[model samples]
Target: MQTQLAVAAYIIHNNKVLLIHHQKLDLWLPVGGHIDQNETPDDALLREIREEVNLEVEILNKLDLPVEGKTKKNLALPFYTNVHSVGDHDHACFYYVCKVINPEKININQKEIKNFDWFTKEELNQKHISENVRNQALEAFKLFEKLTK
Candidate 1:
């Protein structure tokens, strides 16, 4: 079996969290994709968000440090991480919470995304949302609130 590294983002804006109905996976999930070779995880996350939703975002779990010495860059720490089966293979995914920079600029990539919605706290309990994703969304809300406040 093969495992791949991936990045995902729960984009927040206007007191709501974003989820997309993935066309291929047919699941409501955060905007994300496999990290391309030669791309940093931080870059992969930002690129995924932009490609999936056409939105700009700032990763929230990032640490600000001088890019110097042996370390040239700092990447955002994933709030949660897990390995899960995606059909024949598995993905070790890095999950992040991001603050949307242009909330009004979201345009779905129709080729890969079927639909999109912003879920509030209460809305996260809806049956259509998977338990795992719903719980993560709830946690993302808390993290976002904690960071902003």
Candidate 2:
């Protein structure tokens, strides 16, 4: 398995979490992507945010996840958690908590993302959004609240 590093950013505003409807995966996920060969996870996340959401943010915290296990659809994840390993590809992703500096203006990546929305925790819980997505949003929100306070 080829090992690779990636990063994800959770951006929250007005008691709502920013989520993207991924075009390829056909699922809702936090904004993130693979880290480039020379880029740090932080750098990769910042670049991904700018590319995917057209916004800058301040990294609030670093979330460490050990790389192991196969991908599982945990009811408590935005995307499938656990490391991914295939024929020639393997990856472990780091998740980060960040606050969008500007929420009013966003440029969604049309190619990979179908739409973007800010959903309140309750609304998200009640919506048709996936259970995994809601769980991840809540986890990210809890982290945000704890760090910002």
Worst 10 residues of 1 by lDDT: 60-69
Q: Pick the candidate with the highest lDDT.
A: 1
Residue pair clashes in candidate 2: none
Candidate 1 per-residue lDDT over residues 39-129, each given as its tens digit: 9999999898889999999899778888998998888989999999889889999999999999999899999999999999899889889
What are the lDDT figures for the candidates, one per model? Answer: 0.92, 0.76
Per-residue accuracy of model 2 over 74-137 as CA lDDT, tens digit each: 2112222446542367768777778889876799989989998888888787656888667877
- Residue clash pairs of candidate 1: none
The estimated TM-scores of all candidates read: 0.97, 0.78
